[model samples]
Target: MKSKLLLSWWNDLRLKNKLMILYFVAVFIPIALTNTIFYTMTANYVRTEKIKDLKLSLEGNKDNFRKTIDSIISFSTVIYTDGSLVGALDHTYGSEAEVLTAYSEVLNPSINRFVPMNKQFYNAYLYTDNTTLIHSGMLNFIDRETEQQDWYRATVAPSRSRKWMIYTHSQPDPSYISVIRELDFYKLYSTYRKILKIDILPEYLQNTLFDQTFPGKLYLLNPQGDIVYSSEENLPQRLSDTVQQDMTVIFSVFDGVDYLQGWQIAGVYPNSVIERSLLDSRKFIVYLTLANFIFPSLLILGFTRSLSKRLGLLFKGIRWVQNQRFDLLKTERANDEIGQLTEEFNKMTTRIDGLIHDVYIAELNRRQAQFNALQSQINPHYLYNTLDAVRMSCVTKGEEETAHMIKLLGRGFRRSLSWEQDMIPLQEELEFVMDYLEIQQFRYGQRLLHNLEVDERVLDIPIPKMSILPLVENACIHGIEHLECQGTITVLAVQSGTEAHIQVQDNGIGIEPNRLVQLLGSLESSRSMESYADGKHVGLKNVHARLKWHFADDFKLSITSDHSMGTTVEIKIPVSLQSSDDDIEGGIHAC
Candidate 1:
């Protein structure tokens, strides 16, 4: 019973609401939960990896510092054991000139060769206790002030052969990592003590050795735990006093080297640095979560909208049918069930429209038959006899022009009343138009002039009856009736390839631009005949409709006019060469 009730409730919901509920439960909730868990795991993993990378970078810097110190020690060892250097320093000299000559030739040449080979070697000097040796380049006399220095005291201690310490010089004030080695290799020949001090470039140590990709502070501490080198700018002589509790410290101790035995490289990292390292990962997770959420939502909305829109159209179609309107439903090119239903609906509407149209046509034919019966009550022969009598009376009274006009008027009426044939030879249509123009000429004398030009080849073409006459009447009534000057009407017929071209042109006050637009629009509209008859441009609309009924799209009617320069109406129709021999002979003769 519960299952059945649930199913009933589900069936009672609208399609869009049902789809939305399914999406929320199936897609939205599941994706949101999984993405949240995935983002948490990713952030933790990225942060752990960043901390490991920082530790490895600190170890690498420690190795670089060891290598630099070892290189300096190697260079100092060479200077300590050089026999030529020992001989130059131990010589007994008489005057300062002899000292200068021995110093330039022996000591200067040797120092220049080694110092320029490395960018890290700032300067090298030899300090000695020999009173006879002058204080000159690369040779310094060990005065009482030098003996008081810590580096010198450390080097001269009894069994210490070498020492590395950061020392400050007074002349050019900067601290440098100095290497001091005792020159005791020639103990048998020398009675004096000598020391070699080489200063390593402090800028090279600060800029190159500890420059790492990790965003942390690095410090180089000597065995005595003093801050010797730091990567921070404007650091004091000691470490900062305000160390936070959350700061992480990593240490890499130097082993295997006797001089740097207890020295260590220390890295200070903050929690914020680790978080910064995971910034890109966090952004990626956010974007992924949004994509998972938005894309499925858009797809669900699109599907629901498509279903609802088509169903709405179907409901609208049913309402139209209820109101007795058999309008065909427009549908998409789909192979779904809805498309099939729409197709069947359209077919049903088409059949109903056909049945109703047949009934309407039958009723119209019945009414036309009754009207024809009423028209046939009048005797056309009696009307013709009366018109001929009038013409004859005018002739007897010596009114020849009035008699001729009456004869033409009778012929026009007879031609209009006769509708036995719908299609007539082009020659007959032209004759009818000429008769009408002659009557119009009588009405507008001296103000209207007309000309006819016909091509002999198109004289036998079959055209609908009264097609050319309306166009001529429209030209005379609209084009020339209001002209202050004399108006000229030209009718030109020509054959071009497989078509006949006819034009009716007039030189009079032309239509205004706005009015001409309306006239052309009326000709193109698919309005009822009754509406067209009650509105403007009735003659052009009639001619356009008749041409369309006969030839469909094969015939063309176009109007071109300038504001004050005349209007031209041109018609084109396919030429048919199947007229009777008598009609062809008549057309040729008339042309």
Candidate 2:
């Protein structure tokens, strides 16, 4: 055998593994060295660093913008704190007036001028709790949820000391901030407190960082996620777009509210400025990286001349396999390790070729014997043929009971050989078993009971025919056949996604756990079993083998039992491996 193997191995066209491994490394390594491990990684690093630097500069600009905006708020607060303006502004809170009379004596002309200087600051409204707009530089106020929050409402509510807070308008803008001042009107009016509000716009926020030095806009966001100030000429546009939308940041203290609110100010540097800054650095680093990577990889490739030659020969051998020429590998390489491997491979193929022929013959003989044994092993065929003749004679003599038994047997046989197929639609297969159960019921009377539960949706699904019946028959004969009292069989078919599963259960004596393990072992180990009388569970073993033949590991068969609760045999077939809905009826197509 060893001499014949070596001789056969000499002629095979397959390449040995050592050459293929070298070929794979040659093809994959240089590409990764140039693109992934070297060039792309460096580019990614440079881009990340550029973005980080730009973000830091933007933060610096934003702080300056916020301080400048705070200047306007501080200035307004000073005027409101003064003895004269405070009295007039304070009276508006908690009063039910639509507009409070600003006595000409108490009016500071400069303070009035401050409210109209910018478009963002133009519309200021002060509201008292009793539905009064005591001060207005804008339009009419509407009745709506004030978007008041716990901390915000508390700050602006009338109190003994001072309450100061601000919120933006319901409408959004990047260049405006709304300021609210709480009033102490509850003592004077004895009913409620009111809030004093003002809108501050973009120009008031123009500080050193918001000046011409920065590349992008600066912004202030109010507690309600509304943009109230920006340094951009297109401030409103940027606020409406992604930049402001992305900045509705929730701080660490966002547990109680949907979102926490306050005045959040920001400055954005234009993307073009930073991108231009990186161009020369980008070019210098890119060239240096390519220089570092390409030269070394090229040198390595040049030095590995033997590896390249071996791979080229291996490629030629693969091309031969692709064309299905499994014979006679002609090579210039002498009998080194590659030649020895090639010799061993050729012998492996010749052995498989011979084994395939022998296995096919063995399978044919087994099927022939299986057919012969199945026929001769059961005495019911002779009993059925004689019973039918006697039943016809009884029918001629006008005995109805004998005629009924003959009819039931006829129906059983008709369904058993339906289309002479091994598999049929699940609906039809159940009908076949139910027909046989009728014959048994006639013989044994009400002592035999059967329950079948099947999902209606799975009716047209195809399954292995006669497969379910053998288990039920085994339950009836091998299990409960001794009991003269009562016995039950339950056949269940359930559909789970792509699997069409069938279960046959009977309330009879079940096999012990150890014996069941052995039974399963015999079915799984090999296809060739000696005989049906192998003291194993023959019918179940056959079903397991057929399922394996059709679906391989994609199919599943399991049995679970109780000595009192009977045995359940279940089959699972994967959806992807199933045949087409049209072809599933008549043929078993295994891919």
The TM-score leader among the candidates is 1
Write down the TM-score of every candidate: 0.39, 0.38
> Which candidate number would show the highest lDDT if scored against the true structure?
1
Compared with the true structure, what per-residue lDDT tens digits does model 2 show for residues 224-291? 55555555555453345745432322212122322223445554544555556657766876676667
Q: Report RMSD (Å) for each prediction in the order shown.
A: 20.2, 28.3
lDDT per residue as tens, model 1, 1-591: 999999999999998889989998999999989988998899889877887888789878888888877877877778777899888888888999988887788888777778877745467888988889888767788989999888787777775644444343333434557777777789789978888888777787886566657578888777666667777764445555424677877778887767787778888888788888778988998899899999998999998899899988988998988898988888777789888888888888888889889989999997997698557736766687788899999999999999999999889777766655666888999999999899999999999999999999888888777778888887788889988899999999999998999999999777888988888887778346564645566656766776676667898888888866788989999996353444322221000
Candidate 1: minimum summed lDDT over ten consecutive residues — where? 582-591
* TM-score of decoy 1: 0.39
C-alpha lDDT of candidate 1 relative to the true structure: 0.79
For each candidate, what is the lDDT? 0.79, 0.59
Model 1 residue 349 lDDT score: 81
RMSD of 1: 20.2
The residue ranges of model 2 lying beyond 4 angstroms of the native Cα positions read 1-345, 348-395, 410-420, 497-501, 509-535, 554-556, 575-577, 580-591
Query: Given candidate 1, what's the lDDT at residue 219?
Result: 83
